[model samples]
Target: MLSPRESATRERVSLDGLWRFALDPEGRGRSERWWTDELPGDVEVPVPASFNAVLPGRESHDHIGDVWYQRVVRVPRGWDGERIVLRLDAATHRAVVWVSDTQVAEHEGGYTPFEADISEQVRAGEPVRVTVVVNTELHWDSIPPGFVQELEDGRLLQQYFQDFFNYAGLNRSVWLYVTPRTHVDDVTVATTGIDGDTGTIDYRVAVAGDGGHPVRVVVRDAGGAEVARADGAEGTVRIEGVQPWRPGAGYLYTLEVAVLGADGEVVDVYPQPFGVRTVAVDGTRFLINGEPFYFTGFGKHEDFPVHGRGFDPAAMVHDFHLLRWIGANSFRTSHYPYDEAFLDYADRHGVVVMDETAAVGLNLDTGAGVLNQAGPMETYSDSTIDARTQETHRQAIRELIARDKNHPCVVLWSIANEPDTVSPAARPYFEPLVAETRRLDPTRPVAFANFLKATPDLDVISDLFDVLLLNRYYGWYVQTGDLVAAERLLEGELREWAERGKPIVMTEYGADTQPGLHSMLREPWSEEFQIDLLAMYHRVFDRIDAVVGEHIWNFADFATRAGISRVDGNKKGIFTRDRRPKSSAQALRQRWHGTEEPQPDTTRNVQQDPQQDLQGDVPQGVQQPARQA
Candidate 1:
């Protein structure tokens, strides 16, 4: 689906409609033998929305192996001469595409876009049927090994259970493209640099057409006047002194790539809108347009409440609204990279992104207490991390950067999340990896989460990363005596590190929440307590002058299997996992962006109000102690 705000250049055959699903993989080819759902039955799941949320008996349902989705469409006679293509904005980990029993394409990864050229497979003026078979089970032979678990029934399930739920099937858009043989394959515009008055743009165009066909490239400002034009073999074209795109102010430019036939007839044209902002990391300082800015954002997960990780543009837009409303200026793609459209939306909507690689929760022996445990007395060093895991980390980072570098909103390249350096060899593992990132794109700063105090190896590794991000969960992890004491100790330590003149970013901080489930507002675990803790940090931000920025642990609550008692999981989010705003969220809205407005007096009122009437409903003898927040 294209943007509702703007019309698309190509009037696509609205292919995202009600479709049928057949259970049989073999019958996918046979036309009529397949099971067809009555119109408006459970078979037709909304495109870009999670199918797992709508399947029969889907409420809190668990495991599934395979499923089939079939859609029938009557081809327009006018589209007979043009090549028809089927585009799946996203599918699960693995899926095979069949149009009328003819297998056309297969795709891997539940996060990226894939296309199947069904031009030759579909018959014009006939009811064309497209079938998609999806497998959500994790196969060990795949690139990133999936997880396996034994259920209570003694049945083993092989699948990945990350922090968020994995919504299976085709969740993104299904578009049909009627294109001429000579069409634009891809068009990427790189904003090299932007000075005070002028912006520099480098256009890298990839096209598929008759060899030697001339292509015309045009750059237009938001007003639609052609500012720069280039005609060539559709290679790299550089345009200088163009207006630059800035954040918050919503400045955007349009780059049009037109494929011209011998007769100069416009065969196919692709227009991409981009912002040309200069992003840089100076030591530990993050800058856009040469101005230093603090990153106030959340660590966002890809999963939605019901859809799992499926694509819902509207749902994503709603997420963005919450982010903006909360006055967050940035977001970290925690644990894994998100859908491309999410990043694209961030670009235009003025939200900074820490485009992270999908490497998290590895190397650390969760069973151990120490930071790194390679030897009896040994601590974390470079060597303790797994050798096999290093390659997987590199591959995920490479793919993430290669795909997301063009986004202006992406300022930091988060190499990994909460990964441990269990051995001494781990230093060498990271040294070369960070160096390679610089080699790939030295434009953005490289950063990862740092374990505090436990390991001196952090200082050794700090040189490799541009920004040293620390995730301190002092209030939750180690009781550390008292909140004030812990905050003081952390502040002193941070000051000592800042005295080293190293750049620092507090990557994560916040207590868990049970969403309206707290015993005392004064205790650190309470929602009110978490709010007060963050409020204290607002003051610390000024004290730790060297700290360039900080992103709260998360914007909203997310699912985590490794949770603690009372809540069953970490309830650290300021908002509920379901995206409901907590009373503490209001406290943030006031102090966010350094606003001086007086925060609403919710603390006194909430504390004074009688405990909510969730009492008698408590299970048989289970005392409803205030949950964990």
Candidate 2:
């Protein structure tokens, strides 16, 4: 076993360690003390994941846009000319980093990692303060317009109406790193084409501060046997004649890129683990390692109950175990990007990930009109703002791709989910965005979640992307009352796409059911209904060609403001947001992964008994919806 010190040395600092302060740009955080000092007092705001769940008074503070966070940390000693950097693993919307009151970097987009090298600004030996201000305010140019607080009838109303908790604040880890000046800035290794008999490996290494040194790349199999090695200036290499990475038979390799000085001593190095696996979507078919593979996973949001996005490493490991134990091989990073820790774990574990952009479907402009209030065939235009909106959309995509493109686990790049068709601005934003992603990473496919009734605008640009994904809540969103109707709708759509020779991924499925809740008649919200719905979806998928995968709408019940009965929102998760496994979660695991079946007692629905259930019921905090629509 490795000693803690050795483990710590090898383990990258949790991106969550940096200083955090909550204040407005005008100076709300400058005060030495805050108003409330409760255990999780006014100053002790809950991180977004469990924030609202804990702070009832602050529930009204949840909005779409920015809030401010400032934290101070003592500089670690024994450092010389090392980079004193600040990294936010995942921050919603926009982030600005500062060290000792000096601004170093500004990044947009909430999902990917953003860094600022504060080496020159910080004092070498003295303790220095690093502060980060994350603006969750609305900018049409930014994704997910920031927070808005509405007032109604002598009460304050803040609506963060989304599928998941707007777990803002520094949800992912924050960290500081000390690195050699001349180092391998980045290393990208891709398993481009994999066949039973032949395979290809391509890599790109970004080297900086090497003092005119040449970089060397070494490819090693799992046993540390050198498979291929080469030299390059900017750090690029290709390896052929390799065994392809395949699931159920974990085949992986390591690429070690070393930067050498003129005298040949190693100046800096970067090591990345990768698999030479060929993945493609052929006319609605997903081929991995030359085998037709089906996507059996859930749409996962990167938030937890206790820590929000500040995930404990054990929590991540626990999550992987749960996913495997339950029989899932894929997951969609629904709505935003996730921490690198999650991605790295996925890579080693062989889970297929449909890595998503920070963009979402709510960008649709309802013209202040409720969706149901609109007439049939109403002017279905993208409600998003014009050209400026497109630019922000582009930036979000670029940042996400640039940061995470190399991960073998990430097979698909989802551009946006359900950009509103009611606004004319939607298609213009999507088309060029898809084209640009293709230009950057042609090895992977680009797709968007078709949330609306209409065909997505970018579908015609099929040549640019490898797969077509549709987020259908047919059983929940469109035909909740009729399982047959849901099956028909799903089957019909898959058949149409198959005929077009377009590979399709049922990106979203599953119904919202309060755990343990059973219909006296085993109706829609019952455990039986949930199980039947999933099986029916599988049935529909079985009949279609090119239907490679099916992801249920949600992996767990997240934050929903509706405060409906036991489920605050729809309560569709297989596991509660708190990580409690639900009956449906077990049913899916049993059916798909051949996992053990849960006892009848374990499948008791939560909706009927909120206290006994895994605390999935609506708390008294959020105001109940006035007359469910």
- Highest-TM-score candidate: 2
lDDT of 1: 0.63
Give the lowest summed-lDDT range of ten residues in model 1: 616-625
Residue-level lDDT tens digits of model 1 in 388-468: 446655655665666777677787888866545544555776887898788777777788876544343344566567777
lDDT of 2: 0.62
What C-alpha lDDT do the candidate models reach, one value each?
A: 0.63, 0.62
TM-score for candidate 2: 0.82
What value does the lDDT take at residue 462 in candidate 1? 61
Shift in Å, residue 576, candidate 1 = 2.0
lDDT of 2 by residue, 441-507 (tens): 8878778776546454334334445677777766766787588888887777677667657677788
Off-target runs (Cα >4 Å) in candidate 1 are 1-9, 13-44, 56-60, 139-145, 150-153, 158-161, 233-243, 367-403, 424-442, 450-463, 492-502, 518-521, 560-570, 598-629
